[model samples]
Target: MKYDFGEAIDRCKTNSLKYDFIEERGYPADILPLWVADMDFKIPHETAVAIKKSAEHGIYGYTEPKDSYYRALSGWFEKHFDYPIRQEWVLKTPGVVFALSLAVRAFTKEGDAVLIQRPVYHPFSHVVLNNDRKLINNPLVLKDGKYCIDFDDFEKKIVENNIRLFIFCSPHNPVGRVWTTEELTKIAEICIKHHCIVVSDEIHCDFVLSGHKHRILSSLSQEIADNTILCTAPSKTFNLAGLQAANIVITNPELRKQMYKELTRTGYSQLNSVGLAACQSSYEYGEGWLSQLKEYLGENLKYIRHFLAEHLPQVKLIEPEGTYLLWLDFRETGIEPSELDEFMKHKAKLWLNSGEIFGKEGLGFQRLNIACPRTYLEQAMIRLKTAIDSLL
Candidate 1:
């Protein structure tokens, strides 16, 4: 492979949230962190070079992306997802979460309801509550070893709560279930019928595993496109979260206007210069690197499956369909939900995201990020096995 995912680059003292602040986050200083969504792999060579080029220019003035940047960004979506994006439909933001917060304020008023699927990315809840909006959850049901959305409850909640906005996670975080075309269509239909604006966060759209496809939610129909705010970024794709750049697509003129108004209210504009260069470069030249990274991640997934089956069968792998995050069910281990975090930190000496933070439905489960080197995963598995074995 042209890209080496096996090399473990030291992230310590880099002020990395995942590596540098373990102790500050209440985990042991020595604990191995597999919690955050970012990868441990180096970004594509072209992306790094572009960033260095931008930095070497000396003056870090306020910068905006050129038409070429938009071409590259649009070209990526058209090539990968077959979704054509009008350059004017794109809005730049620091991150997807920031876009979600902006959408909440733009589309809904205080005390107005916004719907989200539970056991999802925690920020979906935070964005609503933080903005004084009503939070309504349509919890995804686990059926026959897979997570499925309850469409009836989804529509019911929107109608009952008078929800005007829906924050959606495609190829959802934590559980790692990529929404099928049929599923996305259903969601789009429900939101349209209810006249609710959909903010589809597709940051993990590029990280899908084998045998699954991620459809852009708005690409289904003209009507769906009119009502959807599609949030996307290269942060997860190229492991450039620290750079903080995201492209938010809003096709509807009125919705875009409102979002622009909210963005103006925040007094924020133009992505960081380095982030702009990295994003444009990655979208243009990082495909080969991303392809190899996915293959390596697929192998890492297999390793976890085999290791767990052979050494820690009590823990059930939820079987991720997309993203590098694995949702592991430890219910069979007889670990109480309240004590699970302590067990992972103290016993396993491994830092993972406790499922409860996603929502009540996430209890008894843990979100493990496998976007690191195979050796890191092997060590994490051994740590987990030893921790579980101690109970016996």
Candidate 2:
């Protein structure tokens, strides 16, 4: 591979929220972090080169995304995902989280209920609750070691609460099940029937593992697309979260105008020029690098699964359909969430996200970000095995 996934880049001295700020985040500084969902690998070379060129220009200025940028992004979707997106539908935001918050504010009022599938991303809950909206959890059911949507429960809750908005995580986080096309259709139908707006966060769409394809919820149909506010970004796939370039696509003009007005009201207009360059470079010329990165991540997942099977048999890995995140079921260990948190931090000398934060349903689980070099994961597994063995 031209890019080395095995190479461990030193992120400790950098202002890396994942690594450097561990102490600030209340985790022990000595613990190896596997909690945050960003890659340890350097971004694709062309993206770096593009950002560097922009930096070399010396005048940091406010910017709007160029047609070339939109073309690159749209063209990428067309070539890679077989989905064609128009430039008019695209709204620029610094990050998907912000995009979600914008969507929440745009579509709903204070006291309106926003629905989400729990044991999912923690921020979905945050964005809803923080914005003064009522949060409704439709927890994903863990059956036979994989997560599945409870369709009846989902529609029932929406009807019961009269939910005003739904925040959908595609290629869901924590419990890494990629929602099937049929599943997305049902979700869309339910939202349309209920007159609830859908915010589909497709940030992790590009990181799908082999044999599973990610279908943009908007691509389901024009009606579905019209009802959906799709949030996408190159951040997750290209290791550019800090760069914060999200492309929010909304098909309905009034919805687009509403979101744009909210964004303007919040005083967010121009995007960072370096981020723009990075995003354009990534979507335009980073496919080969992404291919290699995905291959590397695939092996990393396999390594972690095999490592657990051989060393920590009691801990079950929920086979991931997409996303580099792995949801490990450790309920059999019989440790409560707080105790397990302490064990991982103090005894194991490692940091992994406690599943409880995702929702109550994630209590006995651990969300492991496997987007790092294999050597890092192997070391983590060794520490984890030692810790679990001691407990057992």
TM-score of each: 0.99, 0.98
**lDDT per residue (tens digit) for residues 207-282 in model 2:** 8877888999998899999999999999999999998788999999999999999999899888899999999999
Best by TM-score: 1
**Cα lDDT listed for each candidate:** 0.93, 0.89
- Model 2: ten consecutive residues of lowest lDDT: 333-342
Clashing pairs in 2: 94-244
Worst 10 residues of 1 by lDDT: 21-30
Candidate 2, position 277, lDDT: 96
lDDT of each residue in 152-262, candidate 1, tens digit only: 899999999999999999989988999999999989998889899999999999988878999999899999999999999999999999999999999999999999999
* Model 1 residue pairs with clashes: none
